[model samples]
Target chain A: GAGVSQSPSNKVTEKGKDVELRCDPISGHTALYWYRQSLGQGLEFLIYFQGNSAPDKSGLPSDRFSAERTGGSVSTLTIQRTQQEDSAVYLCASSPRQYQETQYFGPGTRLLVL
Target chain B: GESVGLHLPTLSVQEGDNSIINCAYSNSASDYFIWYKQESGKGPQFIIDIRSNMDKRQGQRVTVLLNKTVKHLSLQIAATQPGDSAVYFCAETAPLNAGNMLTFGGGTRLMVKP
Candidate 1:
């Protein structure tokens, strides 16, 4: 079975630039999540989407970060005016259901803001 | 703030030995726990998960144990192999939350010595 997939495995951008990371969730998955992994740190929850419900944006670091799940299948995480602190791996995951379900992850997009 | 954390940052064991990774969570309301393994250049892969109702769950060569009373979780790998060397993370989620967002702990780097 095809797993969750992400695009732009690696991205390098200048400070203050905008970047977009894409994720393709597995077929039939209704829940998608975005997370960030910093060096020597744990996975930080970023945003979440379940079906067509309002996405949870509480985990996002700041106003510059936003994500949209289109048609309940694909998601795009956008960071506007990126900062050096945003240099990290952006990971995506999806699950069959929203509650207490095993999540499949996609190889993250490593973003580097210089 | 409540969060999941690992006691040890790294562990090394001989090949074929049994390895156990421990995690401590602060949210007593958490009812689901999961373990994930990540290689150097890859995203995290689900290893196993255990519900608060169960104390343990086993998968192929991995076992996940959850202790709701103490807010603790552990992942044990039987006959650990070099291929198992990677960073292991434990995550928890409170099913009551609508988002069911997972809070991940600092990863434990497992090294299997040949």
Candidate 2:
């Protein structure tokens, strides 16, 4: 079985540019989540999707950050205007259910804004 | 501080010695806890998890102890090795009604010396 995977393992862009990171969660998983990892920042919850219900957008960093999960499987996180402070690893995780289950993570996409 | 933090930012131990990493979470409603490990260039990997109902849970060689009385959680690694050198993070899920939001700790860097 293939584990969770993300495209463009690494990405680099200039400041003020737009960037999108993709995540493919495990098949049959009903819950998916996005998180960011920065130096000394630990892991910050970004957004979460469960089945086809409304997504939880509370953890999004700011207005510039947004994410959408289509078909309850693949998710795309977009940044309107990239900033140097946005340079970090974008991680995606999924689980069979959101009821006290463990989350399996993808390799993550490292984004660097210059 | 109102965030999850570690007593020590870093811990150094011999390859065969046991290791203990501590975390303090301020949220009294945090009941579900999980321990994750992140390598230098990889995404975080889930090691183990424990609910507030139980005070202890054990994995292959790792153990998680939750002290709800004091809002403290700790991860213990037995027979530590170089392979275990990485940043360990403690994450807690909010009480039942808060959805899937997880608050993560600052993390503790574990250095295993040969």
Candidate 3:
């Protein structure tokens, strides 16, 4: 079976620009999550979607960061007015269920805000 | 704010040797813990998980130990191989959260000497 996957493995963008990263979860996964990893730092929670429930956006760093999951499968993380501080690896993960389950991860999209 | 941290930033071990990575978390309220392995230019792949109720859990060649009293977590790999060399991260999640938005610890880079 195919694992989770993301598009545009690498992206270099100017500051103040907007970028959208896409994620395709594994088949039969009902929960998806987005995370950010800065150099020499831990992974930071961004947002997550569970089935048809309203996505949890509390982990998003700022209003400029937003994510949307369509049809309970694919998810897109959009960064508006990107800043140099937003430069990092954007990782996506998915789980078969919501609790007590393992999350499979994608290869990730590396975004560099220049 | 409470966060997870690794005691060592890097570890080097010979192939076929056992490897141990340690992590400390600040929040006692966290109920779920997970370990992930990430290679360069890749997302984190789940290794093992242990709930607050359990002290230890094992999967394949990996074992995860959790000590709630000291707020510590550790991942041990038996017969470490070159393929096991990667950054390992420990993540925590509280019970109240509806979605699986985990708080990750700074990763420990494992270098296997073949």
Best by lDDT: 1
Best of the two (2, 3) by TM-score: 2
lDDT per residue for candidate 1 within A42-85, as digits (tens), equals: 89999999998889998999999999988988999999999999
Per-residue lDDT of candidate 2, residues B2-62 (tens digit): 4677888899999999999999988887778889998888888999999989999999999
The local lDDT score (0 to 100) that residue A83 gets in candidate 1 is 99
lDDT of 3 by residue, B1-114 (tens): 878999999999999999999999998889999999998877888899999899999999999999999999999999999999899999998766658678889899999999
Model 3 per-residue lDDT tens digits across residues A27-111: 8999999989998678888899999889989889999999999999999999999999999999999999987677888998999
Off by over 4 Å in 1: B96-98
Residue B52 CA displacement from its true place in model 3, Å: 2.3
Q: Mind sharing the TM-score for model 2? A: 0.95
Which prediction has the highest TM-score against the true structure?
A: 1
How well does each candidate superpose onto the true structure, as a TM-score? 0.97, 0.95, 0.94
Better of 2 and 3 by DockQ: 3
Candidate No. with top DockQ = 1
Which is superior by lDDT, 1 or 2? 1
